[model samples]
Target: MSGPAPIHVVVVGSGLAGYGVLRELRKLAPDATLTLVTADDGHFYSKPALSTALAKGKHADTLVTTPAAKMAAQLRLDLRAGRGVEALDAGERVLLTTGGPIPYDKLVLAMGADPVKVTIEGEGATRARPVNNLDDYRAFRENLPNGARVLVMGGGLVGSEFANDLSGAGYKAVVVDMLSHPLAQLVPQQVGDAIRDALAAQGVEWHLGRKVVSLDRADAATIATLDDGTRIEADAVLSAVGLRPHIWLARDAGLETARGIKVDATGRTSDPHIYAIGDCAEYPRGLAAYVTPIMAAARAIAPSALGTPTEIRFPPLSVQVKTTAYPVVLLPAPIGVKGGWRKVSDGSDGLKYLFEDETGRTRGYVLTGSLCEERMDMDRSLSAAEAEREAA
Candidate 1:
């Protein structure tokens, strides 16, 4: 009798999450057939590096580590670049793409998220650019002239990083956010204040507790009107508000979705044959958008996608804030947990803060500047604390 055909795995997306899954799957089943379909050029590039590329003097073109053709050949994948999956038929196990319908034994949705755009009125509102992907970064770089004044909206991680990069690149960066301080959601007020001071010293102007209501065209520049009637002139505007997961694909296909495509610990969707990972997948905890989570999910889901069931267990992960002026490491406290940040240490070099719950359990920690060295120890403590809570 002839041997059964090799199981085909179809991965939709070419981002770090999608490729990470493919890498893991290849290791588990070298002979299995794999295909990658992406809407973009399918080049391998670090999404995190985009925020710091300008400061490092790296061109947009150089950001792509590997082109699609080379990646496909290296990984033995059937790469389909620049094609979108218009519809997904879960019952039939078929994906309707720009090329044609493709069937697979297992399907992975790593579609990723889209940049959240804020609504602004006036003439130059549409001119506000968001550098979420490589293509967007290229266009932003091309339009940015020497000594351009950039108006950055949002004071979160991406916005702060871009502001610092812009300042380092010899551009005037004015950051506007409705929040009282930068990284309000990640760090305490004191920590945010310290970072704000450091970035300000590097020529990053802050417009805290304010929102850009409108954008109008000036002589050759753009005028941004704040909520408080303050007008600022800039050559360009960059929005780093946030990201909304691309869930229409999974939702339209009748898969359960909330903030993102709902998947179990094994990355399996409501339909067992289909799976989701990366920024697009929402686990029990929430959306794991960072690289570490993506890698962890990939390792766990690879076996399950290949017929061997495996569930992922996430460890305490630290989020590193990329502001060279004052490096920050944070382990965010669990949502809805009763806790308050207590100062552990504060010195000229840096500061440290610990989150303690009502039961006197250390839930999370934050370290900045030279204090970042204690990340490993702090992470261990956080894990131990969590374990203690679970046992109780």
Candidate 2:
């Protein structure tokens, strides 16, 4: 009997997730032909660098040089740029795109996510900006003048980091968030306090517990009006509230979506032959919009895509890892791991917060700076929590 024909895989989106899937497919199935389709200019680089671009004294072009064409050449694959997927016909195994229809033995949705848009009134409101991709960052870099006054419209991870970075670079930054504290939902109260203090020390202003009602464009400045009728002025405004997964294609294709393209633990979507990963996927356990989980999802899905029999599960620990200039490191308390925290300060440079369940079993931890010295040992011991309980 003849061997089956080599499988052809189509990966949508050219972000980290899509690139990751393609890289893994190359590793696992060298014989397979892979096609990467992207809507934007497919530049290969780390998205995390956006946070520190200004502080690093770098321009957006410095972030990436190898475009999709070069990456495809290096990987020996077909790359379609500026071609967004229109829909997916799962039953027929066809991918409908703006350019044309493409067939694939397997499909991976790594479409990534879009930055959330805020609703406000005023002239500047119509001109408000958001940075979702390298192009957007380039625009931001070009528009920023020396000592430009900037108003960030959120206090979440993206917002806080932007504030810190821009402020450190000598740009006047003010963060406005309706939340009680910075990174309130993502971090514990104590961690949030430390982050707020750090940013404050860097000359970043905060308008906690306030919402923007509207924005008006002045001759050379933008005026932002708060809900309480307070007004503030800035040269530019950035909205980093949150991200919405790019799920319109999946939804139009009749795939299920909940905050994102719903997928199982191994990145398998509702349609077994189709898979999703990275910021676009909502895993069975939870959605983790970070590079680490994306790598895990890619590794798990690659084998399955290649007709290999394998089962994979995400590590119990899921989180958004951030590398900040303060030299900050954090593994956000995992979802649904209810517990209390005990903090120990090694010095001004390090602080460790341990989360334990009622039984005193280590469930999660957050370490900053030098405190991360204990990370390896803590991770090893925490991994034993399951075996330790089973043995008990």
Compare the candidates by TM-score and give the number of the best one. Answer: 1
Candidate 2: segments with Cα more than 4 A from true spot: 1-4, 313-325, 344-349, 357-360, 386-392
State every prediction's TM-score relative to the real structure: 0.97, 0.92
Over the stretch 1-392, how does candidate 1's per-residue lDDT look in tens digits? 98999889999999999999999999999999999999999999999999999988888889999988889998999998888899999999999999899999999999999889789999899888889999999999988999999999999999999998999999999999999999998889999998899999999999999999999998779999999999999999999898999999999999999999999979999999999999899998888788888999999999999988899877886889899988999988877788899998999878999888898887778999888998988877777867787799
lDDT of 2 by residue, 265-298 (tens): 6777888778898988888766778877788788
In every candidate, how many clashes are there? 0, 0
| Superposition error at 266 for model 2 (Å) | 2.1
Model 1 ranges off by over 4 Å: 385-392
Highest-lDDT candidate: 1
> Alpha carbon lDDT of residue 117, candidate 1?
79
